[model samples]
Target: MNPGGLDYNYEDWTTIMNMTAKTSVLNLTQEEFIYPGNRACSGCGLSILYRIGLKALGRDCIFVVPPSCLTVMQGLFPIAATQMPVLNCTFASTAAIATGVRAAMKRLGRDTQVVAWAGDGGTSDIGIQALSGALERVEDIIYICYDNEAYMNTGVQRSGTTPQGTLTTTTPLSGKAEASKNIPAIIAAHNPAYLATCSASYPLDFHDKLLKAKEIKGLKYLHIQTPCPPGWGCEERMTVEIGRTAVETGLFDLYEIEDGQMKLSGPSQKLLGKTSLRPVREYLEMQVRFKALSDEQINVMQAEIDQKWAGYRDTF
Candidate 1:
């Protein structure tokens, strides 16, 4: 923990979400799984989550990382930033590999956890089928998507997860005209044992959610909002702050869907309920990608955000 403390206070968040943390004794002998030698950009939010994930999953875990920035960042082949076994799979095969790995582990009577880590492009678009197939069978694996909204590994191109009116390589300056796909809701519809949204900015909540997912029996899905400096056109040091702003502004929400009920989790849930939510510009201005928007375009974007935020609030 930093001297200033965790960025998004978890004590306050539990109150807002109407939930409480359960006590547990963390064993000290678990081997540290992640090291600092990876190639992620400085202050990358996903890297932070990956570090904490290694802590939660422990060294007995096997990571199935598909073709994404993680693949390159993990280093070419024989070497990886992770101390545990890492299986580099095709861009759209993470979930499938995870399923296979989990089954093999069962056959071997090994208790190691299998995790499928992917990007938004790999999750919402190209890899959806593989993910769906894995989830449909209720595979005993955790599937996590560190969503940066675009295909950051491939030159910051737009993906189905990219928000409406956001700029990207494929949808540069003019902005994307289509709506971002609703991946969490889609996964929730599958009625998995767990489906949650999180951010690296909120470490305690991030930690608790991982712990909760680990306890669940069937398929678990965590959609984490990761800020990319080079991709989002922001300063490297601003990764945590930018990720915090995203949730505070309703661009992202920390919540979980279990069985069929959706529960909003995080301190910002109450803040977002205020009559006046922060303008989309406050959120957009943090990244250079939205610097080209005209006043009229911004107004249109704000209206869209208002509608989306209102809808989310209604669900709570």
Candidate 2:
């Protein structure tokens, strides 16, 4: 049962799931929350996700953003890009600040949804402790980590979530040695009321996931793979294509974990077997950041992806 005392039956779930059809574009609200002009780079994946996500979230929500690309995208102080209320917080205090915001709303007899928006560095590395605490306490908030792999806003530095063999300012010649941290798996271990993985290439899928999260109570965590044109060394116009290719190559999978149960969704659902996935090399070749990766390194990545899918096939 939802907080509103409404039961979300299996049929209702099916209806929501089926709404991802091409015609579902008509289902999105015409309302605009994010303004047209902003500081976002050309072909920014976050721009696409932000627009659709706000439409799904509507106006009855508050955003707690950390010091990241979004902070720059939203503009400084007197000037802003979004049409909603946003609280700018420190890099490592996003979730803690969001918790305080939620408490304030409840004290005022308001039920506004509190959302914490942060980048990969802020989430998987710096702010993880606070996030883990929030999840453990089952805080009534939505936390979204827009993973662009590196700390893009900070001169493309290597972050905990930066993929292995991907060149960054900190790891220029040989690229990062450590593999990207499995953030979704880490977050899933907390077992929040709702958890989902989304990609910027599929905005409608993300929109539907946000809508579903809004209906649920307790901690809700969403991780989105946002493509960075400048950071990833791809052409500005190739952002969407790169993001789509990431999923098609099985480097990233889209799915939801509701109350500890996991299920594949969107394009990833159609790609159940390893044979259905495209070559990981295809995805890597598109980005200049992977230029340093040797053929052997690429093969290692591909083998890892295949092994992952093999496990998924066995489980789901």
Per-model TM-score, in order, reads: 0.86, 0.92
Ten residues in sequence with the least summed lDDT for candidate 1: 22-31
Whole-model lDDT values for every prediction: 0.80, 0.89
Candidate 2, residues 272-291, lDDT tens digits: the string is: 84466899999999999999
Instruction: List candidate 1 segments past 4 Å from native.
Output: 1-31, 308-315
- Determine which window of 10 residues in candidate 2 has minimal summed lDDT: 1-10
- TM accuracy, model 2: 0.92
Output the number of the lDDT-best candidate: 2
lDDT of 1 at 28: 15
lDDT of 1 at 49: 79
Candidate 2, lDDT over the whole model: 0.89
